[model samples]
Target: MDWDREARTGLPEAVFCAGKTPAQIDAILAEARAAGRRVLLTRLDPARRDALAAKEGLDYDAASATAILGGPAPARPGRIAIVTGGLADLPAATEALRTLAFCGFAGELVADVGVAGLWRLLERIDAIREVDVVIAVAGMEGAIFSVLAGLVTAPIIALPVSFGSGVSAGGRLALDAALGSCAPGLVAVNIDNGFGAAQAAIRMLSPRGGTAQNAGPS
Candidate 1:
């Protein structure tokens, strides 16, 4: 763990828990505790979360597969809007929201506003326009990315979710769509990388200074 990441990059180092074993996670948590640090764990599946539940101060969210060891950072100044193409994209959106929360930034989830139902997204356009940054989550062809980017003035971060079958099975189609989008200034992250999207928003929110502090464990 790079303990001084928050001081150097304006964000703390987060543990990616995809391939880590239970004992390894335990050791990391133990080290963090000894150092009196606040840590965020991403990609923490349910089984791992259950195994580590005994650790005090462990806050887990199964939907997004995320955990916070100490606690969320204090609220900071920034408004983020997370828009999802459909109900199936909620998991990815939730991850972005959780990341924002852990980083001390607040985000509003605008769910199920895909281009399939143009009226639904149009209805919420005003609210989505009020934020400093926008994260658009979608699977399938990912037309929502371009649509939202064209509609919103804030920078758009397209998060392609792996939530479809057939040709769109693993989100490659969505990823390609996001990459090929003609919308100017639209950027994209990997498939289902909500954490990355949130980090981009954080960078945009704090371009000059880092809002996060390396505080002791709560």
Candidate 2:
């Protein structure tokens, strides 16, 4: 994949930390960072982050369940907001945010703002309106994206997280919700596919899908 498109678009490469062994995740991260790129690791285990302590310029977020590569956030020409439901959704949400930051967009996030508390989302209306695009990182019903699409002018990238238990077939509900979104602006990504969502968002924001030199995953 053209990971560098994110760089051209001013976004970062993302790591999927689920299912894979810690060593695999770490190695993948090494490749990305070695190319002078920052990364966002999602669904990473606590132990995994601990093992990576030897690495400098790393920021770990237990709440967000993410690890951002070293260095300051990248600057963006347009605004992209990432909204998540509960604290549990933060890990995936942060992954999206880091992707945007790595890709070159100054991204923003609104955490714990699911439909249960519409007011919380309403309060951020100003911030939502200011952004050019939005990435909704959620599990469960994934209604957050629909709500955002209804309320904001910006396009929304809906991510169905695979965090729910029960007969509730792994993010299927979230995916269905996104697919059923009546709002014209809602776009859905794969289940727990923050990398895909971020790449798509950045491509739309970037000029002409960015240059080939900036293509491919870093």
Candidate 3:
């Protein structure tokens, strides 16, 4: 596959591995790298990482149940801040940051500051305000988006993950929470889609955001 669309439009191709075999993963990786584009793989099982470590790079953060590929770290300008509900949400946030890096865009990761404690989010307002975009990863009520929308002027990317348990209504509670938000500028990608969120942010930050015309955002 021609993977240059990512670099061409400032959006990277994401390989979601929540349900793929090692062979499939390897094939995708080979194709992506062959096209001279960065390859970002997320949510791999522990054993899978070990199986592919020799051929593919890995940043194993066992606590987060995440396997990261920080390849090509997109050479982007401007800061993109990543905020998670708490330490529990690090895996997803790290995934977001990793995806950003793959597109050559480095970003800041802020965790353990859920809106439950308003003061925590308040303290980071100054720093959060400076980011060109904000990726809010939350679960179990996921009210973080509403609070963040009120706090920052930058475009907010609300990501609802399967962080909540059964009674927690899976991630729907979080999804509903974000959608219910009255924030005009706030937009959502998909469930636990940190890679997608990061990709969109870069597009907006690139070449004055959407003004690049049919030539593909110069």
Candidate 4:
């Protein structure tokens, strides 16, 4: 089924189900199970996940719209810090947490830290700095990336969540803010790409199966 992606990339292929039909998703799941491989499906609807989970060895997290086959990885070192700008960003933040759990890393969630009330973030700065890498999830201009970069020495992985309408809507502005930030240690993933962000952190933290304590920023 051409699932050799894991062999080449050192990461498993994830099934993105936004446009795929149920039968297609089922076929892919079957193939992965047959090969004894672990798989992740993103953008899956709740009803579909509930229906599939009934008979398959799948566990679903509706908040993240993600489903996992095969058990999670064994626990490892290097914690991940997931910071969300607002409540609207929880879904994506949860996605990063679930992905980090699957990847065998512990993750901490710092919620509702939008720029509008910078105090929320400042209060949690000490906790956030304790992690190996930070996944900053935000919408509406994504100032969290630059702010965190300025304060912490950890590597910041920006995840821009898309919502709202018109020009600054759908996370374009947020994505731009992260990419265009003058901060020294900021990195970025696509809009709502929590899974990708998690993978990046995992690789950075566990390069060659070793802790990244001295691997430099993130």
Candidate of highest lDDT? 1
Model 1 steric clash total: 0
Candidate RMSDs in order: 3.3, 3.9, 3.5, 5.0
lDDT of 2 at 86: 74
In each prediction, how many residue pairs overlap at the backbone (N, C-alpha, C within less than 3 A)?
0, 20, 7, 0
What's the C-alpha lDDT at position 46 in model 1?
95
Q: Could you give candidate 2's per-residue lDDT for residues 20-121 as a string of tens digits?
A: 776776677777667876567767778777776345666776755666776545465787888888777766676677666655667787788888898888
Error of 3 at 84 (Å): 1.4
Q: After superposing candidate 3, which stretches have Cα over 4 Å from the reference?
A: 31-37, 53-70, 208-218
Clashing residue pairs in candidate 1 are: none
Q: What's the TM-score of every candidate structure? A: 0.94, 0.75, 0.83, 0.88
lDDT by residue (1-218, candidate 4, tens digit) is 44665455555578888887777888888888788988878889876665563336888888899888897877888878999999999988888887887767788999999889999899999989888899999998788889999999888999999964676599999999998999986999999999999989978875573432333222
Candidate 3 lDDT, 1-218, residue by residue in tens:
43545445545556667688777877776665566555556677777766663455655555434544544662657799999887767767777787676667788988878977878888988999998889998988888888889888999999887777775556788888888888778888777777777777877787752322344433
Lowest summed lDDT over 10 consecutive residues: which window, candidate 2? 209-218
Q: List the residue pairs that clash in candidate 4.
A: none
Better of 2 and 4 by lDDT: 4
The digit string of per-residue lDDT tens for model 1 on 118-210 reads 999999999999999999999999999999989989999999999999999999999999999999999999999999999999999895766
Which is the better candidate, 1 or 4, if ranked by TM-score?
A: 1
lDDT of predicted model 3: 0.73
